[model samples]
Target: MTMKPYRSMLFVPGHKGAWADKGVNSGTDALILDLEDSVPPVEKVAARDVVAETIDRLTGQGVRPDLWVRVNPEETGLMNGDLEAVVRPGLAGLFLAKIYNETDVVRLDAVLSHIERLRGLDDGHVKLLACFETAEAMGSCEKIVAASGRMVSALGATGPNADAGRSLGIEFTLEGLETLYMRSRVNLALRQIGLIHPMAGVWQDLANLDGLRTFCEDSRRLGYRGLVAIHPSHVAVANEVYGPDPEEVATARRLIAVYNEAEAAGSSAVDFEGQHIDIAHVKTAQALVDLAEAIEAGS
Candidate 1:
């Protein structure tokens, strides 16, 4: 699987085209043009057009970050119209909101296939980032993620008082201990299905930068490769937490060097920085170095 580095996916209101450029400049790895909750009921149709135009404009301007649109749920009659308007060139994928089951993914795959054929785009060119919001969706997380080859990542595991919280009736807390079970289950399912970089949902408290940092750090520790940032201030925090630390990169390089020397000397194991170094350790070190390099190159 080709992994895209999405350390920070910033949400931008589709109705506000001006915010698109601001989101791009905010240093987010990707921008999610939100047409579901952010756009008012009366402005949905206009927002789609605005989002499409902004996508075209961003691509024309040679923006580096991938652009994704968070379309309304499949149950909404507006999903088809939103897809039709935004499936043009420069759209990276769709952030499927409020997905309930594998059936939703299958239906979306079929729709995307039809759109690709009509638009002359390559098959499976438009990826999917499924949002598991409801209790039903979370229960079938594994099946939902495996349902579509176009699905690149999953989200909505921890959004408080939103789709997930409201669906589960869980209250919001900064500690996030309440949603640990759900988050861990979702993360394990994603990993089991080979979706290594599934996104942890947004941190709603905009005033708490420290809390956001702690959340990102905790998410990273739990094997989340990225996060959805509701504010630009959280972008840097996410990137910093998700990206490899300088000390870690240095240690990885040293580990690689020591392991290589040990291997060349006809030994399978060695001592490095008071830790037992072996093939498995070396492989982990190499992956860390590679990730660090990829982040650096992208930056």
Candidate 2:
């Protein structure tokens, strides 16, 4: 089944089952119950069951926000266990971490297919979201996203002081000039496959809502449709930043109207509120309007 793009994907420690509800209550568009870095090694096994149950608990007929789980990396010898435990009916997708290249996604796709069959799910029912953490993954992002039809979403995930920054040996900045090229490439990869709603990474400063907003704004300007949030407090900021404001949507509608009027009068383009409006501008405006409608329908 196809899913909507999540505006705010908030991470919750899988072992901390109680926090899942708290995260949902924070108004996140999706809940990523994690069994990866957030969970201690000793509790890794247990967290799988916790996340599975959490999915079962929160998911129901007509559930609004979807549930996604971030399983451990294949190298840890724990991904199989993680998938076996949580690939139940309620799971919307799997966030595959430490992805290196297209081969990794292909292998996981096969495994997920097998699990879906076992769980009585339709083939390709469970989608995959790629998390570009390592340098290899970042560089081969285009191939990875294009590798699998089940690859529903892909994120560049270049958070400061985190796996990406450490792996790429780039310093994080609020202006994001250091990873601008990397981000631009990833954004291009996303657009190459028509996955316009690409998501971006963690904002480490949990208490700094302003910083979070800045990071989200940077992503928005760079063409990201959503964000991967670490803390519940960041959910609102992510939603607000990535989502279209009323005025923006209204402007898009007006642009569409003006373009239609110009075309009816046999003009290919015209001045739209002092800005040139053409087919290209109408298309862009239509996209914003479409996104606004999708968000409204989902809400």
Candidate 3:
């Protein structure tokens, strides 16, 4: 599976068909048609069918952002039915909720394999976006991520009063000091395992756009590659905050140029902008530029 850059993933209630189109037009990198939280208990089955039809509609129109489904947890006994309804050609993958350990991921992978074969999709075509909303999941972050090649990214930012907060009993704050340790641990595990773009969870205060921006900026600075936004309004904020700034891109290009010139002159390092730069710095600059270029092309 090709790894797509996900700066922002907007959540659309699976039961609401109109919101899916709005979500796609909201400029998010991807859309998560949620069958778990947003849909009421009585509507879960109907929501699955709605999500399936939405996937077909979006793909038939050749939409931009990828479509993902947030399926019910395995414990619910509704996941199998959810998967059956939404695992189609246009569907990108699943956003697994309430994962506890590697065993959960392994079971999911087995199910995906069977689904792909049944649907005639390529092996591993249905990727996973794992959400660590429980204390056990956070404790076993490394194992969970390493469990499946199908996981595109692992998320550790379950909001306050949600699964993680309830399980861990951590208070939520704007500064995020309470969950800092867990977030840092998850980030480190992802980096160590080579999943560079782990997603931060949703900012629930929908009315406070400024607060949302601050939360996203903080996450970006903390090495999170993107955010999961519940509202369409937060989409642009995530994209901008996670994206390389114009000034940063220009500096990266200039740094690479200076480094190349230095190397041509029989020098492996160069004094550029009052700082000494070597091949390591050049590689970083090149990477930033490459990311910028990719984002531009995708846009």
Candidate 4:
């Protein structure tokens, strides 16, 4: 599946199939059907079929958002069942939950390859999106991410009392300086691997749109191009924060036009609205325009 540089991916509880419609209507860039934490112990087995049906229905209806599944980890002895149920035609990727090291990465890769072939899907048909939520995972993130060619993007996994905070034995803060080092390290690892559009977080506050907006803005400033959201309402906030807004897109187009004109006149740099722009600036502007176009084309 081609990545959309998702601005927001909302997780829908696998057992609550109806909520899937609500998520699609909420304008999220993608849907992560949860067969892990959101599902209860009693519903774990049955929820797999429900999630599979939801994927098939959405795919049949031609839903715009790419569908993903957050499968159970191997420790639970339920991951094999989860993967068997969800890795089909409609699945775009899997959120490699609770990955602790490169060993876990290789194991998951092998499992995915087996399932893909067994189901008549192409080799590497499904992609992996790593989650750095445990201390072991956090410490060896670079190795884990590089362990598989199936990795497309990763989430830094910061949250209040979530696995990340609890595993690292840290408290959460609105300013986020407490977890800044780990988050920053994840960003650096992604950069070294030549991956752009690194993502982070789950706001966890369903009612506080204002606080969620702050989290989104702060994440964008930290070089994260997207975010993991639990609620659909958070989608608009994320899209706005990580946006190549209309004005930015317009300015980029104008800058490209002006720069091209200057080059034709035998100049290397030109003043554009009090800012000196050169080829470097042009490349940045073009990237913004391209992202804007992609977001426009996606659901």
Q: What TM-score do all the candidates reach, one by one?
A: 0.97, 0.94, 0.97, 0.97
Whole-model lDDT per candidate = 0.88, 0.87, 0.89, 0.89
Model 3 score (lDDT): 0.89
lDDT of 2 by residue, 33-138 (tens): 9999999999999998899888888885345678889999999999999999999988889888899999998899999899889889999988888888888898
Cα shift from native, residue 161, model 1 (Å)? 1.8
Tell me how candidate 4 scores on lDDT. Answer: 0.89
Model 1, 1-299: lDDT tens per residue? 45587899999999999998889889999999999999999999999999999999999998978999999886889999999999988999989888889998999899999999899999998999888889999999889988988888886557766778888898878778888888888888888877778788689888899999888888888888898988888898888889888999899999999888989999999999899989999888888888888877777
lDDT of 3 by residue, 82-120 (tens): 998999999988898998899999988998899889999
Candidate 1: give the clashing pairs: none
Question: Which stretches of model 3 miss by more than 4 angstroms?
Answer: none
lDDT of 2: 0.87
* TM-score for candidate 1, residues paired by index: 0.97
Q: How far off is model 4, as Cα RMSD?
A: 1.3
- Give, for candidate 4, the lowest lDDT window spanning 10 residues: 1-10
Model 2 error, position 169 (Å): 1.9
Better of 1 and 2 by lDDT: 1
List residue ranges in candidate 2 displaced over 4 A: 1-3, 61-63
Per-residue alpha-carbon lDDT of model 4 for 27-68, expressed as tens digits? Answer: 888899999999999999999999999999999999988899
